[model samples]
Target: MSCQHEESMHLESISQSSTDHSLVVPQCPDDLFVVSQAVKRVKEFYAKHGEIKESHGWNHIQAVCDHTRKALLALDYTIQDNVVVEIQLAALLHDLDDKKYFPNTPPGEYPNASAILKEFGISPEGSRKNSYEKIILMISWVGCSENGNTVPKQVKDTDAYHLLIPRWADRLEAVGSRGVVRCYQYNQEKGLPISSPASPRPQNEEELWAKYATSDKLQEYMDRGGTSKDMISHYYDKLLHIARPPKDIVRNSYLEHQAESSSKDLVEVCLRYGKSGQVDKEYIMSLS
Candidate 1:
């Protein structure tokens, strides 16, 4: 969502419960305060056990927040009673109980994350609980079943897709700059190779195909040689699939950034490490 950034919200006071390790917002939160404090609490909350994965750690949350702001700014939205705030709030806590980071929490249960929300009086019967849980469930990976949202009760004209605004915002991070960072980080954490002569820079489209590309799905692509366990392979299989902006407005902005007479060089921009981070350029494709 190549949108202008949204204004920042502030959280004045937040503390963790020592007796129970649950977070407590210092104030009787207004919508802005609840959302802002939730965002502030994510890092500490997840880091409490010291097992947060670097790939999806607090920093990833910040990136998604930035992406969320951009998405909101790009939308031709008409708000109905702080729905935007609720979307962002749900986005803020999207990964609170992610299986990758909080394996013990498991699906079908809120566990510790629910306790944090409870301290600020966010629960099933709380004022914002229904909306909060709704948005969170919608954005979560497990929220969908059979390619449709688990909550399939469509609403008025635009609200039917209202939840998708935040959903798209959150996924933006999975494809672009943040995606590359995460790919490399995950490879490092899992001890996967970044690149080698065997998996050198892809010289053709077929070579760049994901290692998981089946012979049937992408026959020609599968014909190209590759090792399935490398970092580049992992990206080609998953992250690159999300490189293009999913929304029309955001896609328009993304196209504007594409190089003249080029296929956007999306991967190159990421592998370039646009923000001065690590990069691997073994692929021979020329990127402007």
Candidate 2:
């Protein structure tokens, strides 16, 4: 199928899945207002750049919004009106820099995208002003590591977690699994080691074993007919790998034991706190 056709089909599938799962909430009055204003701002920004393709343009925003809404609902979290609006705005305009400023090249080679958002009047001073900045940061986070300081760990976790679900479900089926296997085969053919085991090492042996042990636990979850929630939980844990150190320090202090006694289970310990701790402690603290 053509790229346009594939994009349309993907959007249709997302819409149908979202509806079937009762994922799309009717917009509250406040949410509607924010969405409308954001939509107008996004439209105007894109218009100045010339004709924008829907698949590569607005529909991408729709997909992200749909996935994000479903994720929030699944977590039994209240979807605040402004939060949804901000997330939508971020999703919509995240790629604007790629489309306009970079065009043929990648956005990372240029200045930060948040600066461009500010230039486009998307970052007008108010509570909503920071929304644009947040979105720009998320875009950069996914695109490149350099200018991703503004991308909160929460936003990154939200985006990555949502993107992984459909794939997880799809890959659960035989055909999809075969497709993934085939892709791996192709990668191997192209000189990638698609299934190589890690070389044995003595350094950090305990930490390495702890990592494998957690992987075993996740595999056990999958073996026992794991639901999407289980998978999401696992993915969330994986994302929190960096947050474990401070938590370990604190937990060790609490136990009146040296940090050395704490099992060097980096992934599990890190995942226990997840992205929230990573953001507040690692990201924001670094900024200060």
Candidate 3:
């Protein structure tokens, strides 16, 4: 099937599914000349990067745009010309850095992808920068693989909630430390505030024990337990596992040691910041 056809099918399935929040198709305004131009630029940008055979290729951008639009619709967002344009821009540009700089590596070790977007005038400082910065920052937060970066409580909570509800929590968790840390850092950079008390400082082995001991946390959050701590814990554990490497690799040689080590380290950083009370719970939970 054609890529467009496949995209349409995916969108239709998303729209028809009762689990997804309802969405309204947006109408383009007659005077949206600038938006049209932005879309054109975005198309060109994707075309250029699409040649790479990796996750950040052209079709990936298209898929993200489709998913993003549906996500916005589910939230009852208006998807105005500018919002649509920004979403497209953010989706396309989000992984530019990863594609160009870290294609072979996990997304955690790479620097901010927004720097390039900003240089190209596609970011907050550009002409139509309304929510552009926030959007980019949100994408960055969700995309990052490191910790110590603080995210607004709301964004953190929203994202965490989405992770659990849609069963993407495991994937998000699987991103391990690097992903969670980056997400937290993005949230903090945006000045998003924390809604709850900071988690206590996790001691030496406490971090590891807390994770295995609280595996139930995952189930609790999935089952709609009151607080977001469980989700946070689950994410933390996943990140930790990714960042650290197992000692008995020879016995389990199939494991990607480097990737596993990176993942564990990434989660460790997230735990540090989270215990320091830097991450925003509400924001992570609010993701659609």
Q: How does model 3 fare in lDDT?
A: 0.41
Enumerate residue pairs that collide in model 1. 201-282, 201-283
Q: Show model 1 residue runs off by greater than 4 Å.
A: 1-29, 141-159, 193-201, 205-228, 245-266, 269-288
Tell me how candidate 1 scores on lDDT.
0.48
Better of 1 and 2 by TM-score: 1
TM-score of each: 0.63, 0.36, 0.37
The sequence of per-residue lDDT tens digits that candidate 2 reaches over residues 173-230 is 1012222232223333444432212311223445434653343443444454432222
- lDDT for each residue of candidate 1 in 1-288, tens digit (9 for 90 to 100): 111122321111121112311222122236557766676677677677566677777776665665554444444544443566656655666767765556576556655556667766767676767774765454453221111222234533434555554455444555455555565666677677765443335444454444333233222223442224555554454345434333342332322232121223435633443233444453222220
> Alpha carbon lDDT of residue 210, candidate 2?
61
Using lDDT, rank the candidates from best to worst.
1, 3, 2
Worst 10 residues of 2 by lDDT: 167-176
